[model samples]
Target: MRVFDAKLKLQSQLRLMRSENNTIGMVPTMGALHEGHLALVRQALSENDVVVVSIFINPTQFNNPEDLNKYPRSMEQDSKLLSELSEELLIFAPGIREMYPESVESVSYNFDGIEEVMEGKHRPGHFDGVATIVEALLRAVSPDRAYFGEKDYQQLQIVRKLVSQKQLPIEIMGCPIVREPSGLAMSSRNERLPKRLRKEASFIYKTLQAAKVKFGTESAIEVSDWVDNEFNIHPDLELEYFEIADAETLRPIRRKQKENKYRAFIAVYAEGIRLIDNIALN
Candidate 1:
């Protein structure tokens, strides 16, 4: 596999592929390669003539300075993992300055009201940072399709909106949420969890499952309360926010509408390493 840190060189290489009418697929990620990320890459490889995986830990996305400082980086290890998948894969691991030559600041985006709840409500300016980096990468690679995992379902929705609003000629594909055998949603932050807490983290998914079951018979508020109680009793996991919202609009709802799909979104702190997950209620 070839790695390019310079955006100009990467664009030049991709331009040649475009000239040959070779379809390109992109998998944008922060470095800390895991099976979940590889799953996206595998899907891209199956459908596209060429695939580009951009591994730049975007600084603008993190609202908390400490979280940004503590975020993991393992370029050497990440490169090894990608090489195992395919030698033809193009790896774009750009430095911060390369990505943001002028300054490391995010461009503001409206995202309609999609940016007003759940993650958006909690992490201020987070999606703007996400939109900024994603737009930059999408422009740089000029891929026909870009793949994103649905684990960050809100972000996925926002990205769809961003592309729609910007009229970018790219398909934003949302892949399924990959999980461990224990049901814990796969996240780079999972690496920071202590061994004991790692096992305990499975409860986060279990709670979501139970909440889903309850949604069948109970009210949204009732299920929300149950989720809150579950985490309140747990010693290791602390509930941050739980909302059952319309899957498409992402507005928290008290009653499920007959025509609208719904999902249960939960965020929790597993000993200070924040993990978020969601499950479809209908």
Candidate 2:
């Protein structure tokens, strides 16, 4: 895999590939490569002539500075994994200054109503930071398609909005959430989770699964309450919020609509490491 820290050099390489009519795909990530990240890379490899994965930990997205400080970084291991994926995979692991130079002004985006729910509401300016970095990466790579995991369902929707609002010529592909055998949603933050709490983290997804089942027979409020109670069973798992909402707009749904798609979104803290997961509610 060829690794480039400078965005312009990477863009130049991609532009030359474009001259030869090669289609490119990009998977933007914040390092700490796991099965979840490789899942996206695999999909991109299958469909595109070239795949570029950026591993810069975007500082602007984290509202809690401590969270940013603790975010994992394993570039050596990450490179080894990507190298195993394909010798042709381009790894863009740029430094913070490389991504946001001192002279560049901070960029913010209006995501309309999409940013007002879940992650956005809880972490103010989070999505704007997300949009800023994603927009920069999209512009730099200018790939035919970009890949993201559905685990962050709201962020996926907001990115879709960002691409639309900016009129960027790129397809945002949302891949399925990759999980462990115990049903825990795979995440980089999982590394920080104490090994004992790792198994307990599966409770987050298990609760979501149970909530999904109960949604078929209970009211939104009832199911929400049920989720709250389910998490109470595990003192280590702290429930922040759970909402049954319209999948499209992410607006909370008081009543289930046959015509509208819905999803259950939840956020929890397990041993102080925050984890988020979502499931489609039929």
Candidate 3:
């Protein structure tokens, strides 16, 4: 595996690959790799001649300072795990200094309302930072295909928009969300959960499952209320938001929704760490 920290050198090498008609796949990650990340890497390996994984914990994406301070980081362990997966894998491990040599300001392309709701509303400039770093990474890697897990469904959609609008010559593909057999979605943040709470964490998925079952019969408001009540039953779980929104736009449904289709997005604080999951209801 070849690793490069400098953006120029990585871009130069990537250009050579494109020149030679080698298919390139990019998997952008925040490090502290988990099954969710490995799933993306494996997908990239299957479809492209070369797989490139980026490990940069972007600081600008964090709206909460304390959460930023607490996010996991294990470079050697992450690299070791990736090494065994694909011998031809390329790693872009740029330091904050290397990534952002200037001020924290980012010249970003926004999706207007799309960038201002759900995860965006909760995290403030979180997605803006995400968009910025992603644009940088996409430009640097310039992969023929980029893979993202549906675990971050909204973010993946936004990236698809970015790629489409920017005409960046990249295909943004959303892989299935990897989950533990118990139903809890796999996440790097899962490591922060206390063991006991980790087990209780599966309840989040169960609640969503119940919500999904209501589908055509229940009103959006009704299903949302049930999810809220389910979280109420588990007082240990701090409910952030349980909402039904437009799948493409991520906007809440104030009244009845047409096409009777929407996405169920939920975020809760379990064991002091926030876990998010979503399902599509049609």
Candidate 4:
């Protein structure tokens, strides 16, 4: 596998591939490779002639400076992990200056109301950072398709909206959420969890599952309350926010709509590390 830290050189190579009619797939990441990340790259490799995995920990995406500092960075380890998957893979590991030559601030975007709820509500400018880095990466790579994990269902929806509004000719593919055997959703942040808390973190998914079961006989608000209560009783996990919202609009609903699909989104703090997960209801 070859790594390109320079955007110009990477784009120049991609242009050659374009001339040869090679379909390019992109898997954008923030380093600290995990199975979940590898899963995206695997899907990209299967479908596209060439896959470009960009591993730049975007500073613009972190609203909290501490979270940004604590975020994992293991390029050598990440590169080795990718190499085991495919030698044909291209790695775009650019420096902060390379990604943002002028300023490092996130550019604001109006992703309808999709950017104003759940994560958006909690993290303030988090989605703006997400939109900014994703737009920059999309522009830099210009791949035929880009892959994202469904674990971040909200971000997935917002990215689709961003592409539609921008009229970008690229397919945004949402892969399934990879989980541990205990059902904890795989996240780069999972690394920060204490050993015991890591096991306790499975409760987060269990609560989501129970909430799903309750949704059939209970109201959205009722199910949400149950989820809240479950976390309240848990010793290690603290619930940040749990909402059953329209899967498309991501607006929390009071009652389930017969015409609309619903999903339960939850965020919990295991110690100081934040972990998030979501499940479809009906």
Best by lDDT: 1
What C-alpha lDDT, on a 0 to 100 scale, does residue 89 get in candidate 2?
A: 96
The global C-alpha lDDT for each of the candidates, from Candidate 1 onward, is: 0.93, 0.91, 0.87, 0.93
TM-score for predicted model 3 compared with the true structure? 0.96
Task: Go through the candidates in order and give the C-alpha RMSD of each one to the true structure.
Answer: 0.8, 1.2, 1.5, 0.7
RMSD over all Cα atoms, model 3: 1.5
Where does candidate 1 have its weakest 10-residue lDDT segment? 251-260
lDDT of 4 by residue, 1-282 (tens): 889999999999999988999999999999998999999999999999999999999888788899999988898899899999999999998998998899988998999899999999999999999999999899999999999999999999999999999999999999999999999999999989888999999998888888889999999888877887887888888899998899888988986669999999999998889999999998
Regions of model 1 farther than 4 Å from truth: none
lDDT of 3 by residue, 49-164 (tens): 98899999998998888888999889999999999998789999999888788877565557857888889888888888988899989987888899999878889888988888
lDDT tens digits by residue: candidate 2, 1-282? 899999989989988998999999999999999999999999999999999999988888989999989988899999999999999999898888887887433477777787878888899889888999999999989999999999999999999999998999999999999998889999998888888899988988888888888888999999998888887887798988998899999999898878999999999998788999999998
The number of residue pairs in model 2 that clash at the backbone is 0
Per-model TM values vs. the true structure: 0.98, 0.97, 0.96, 0.99
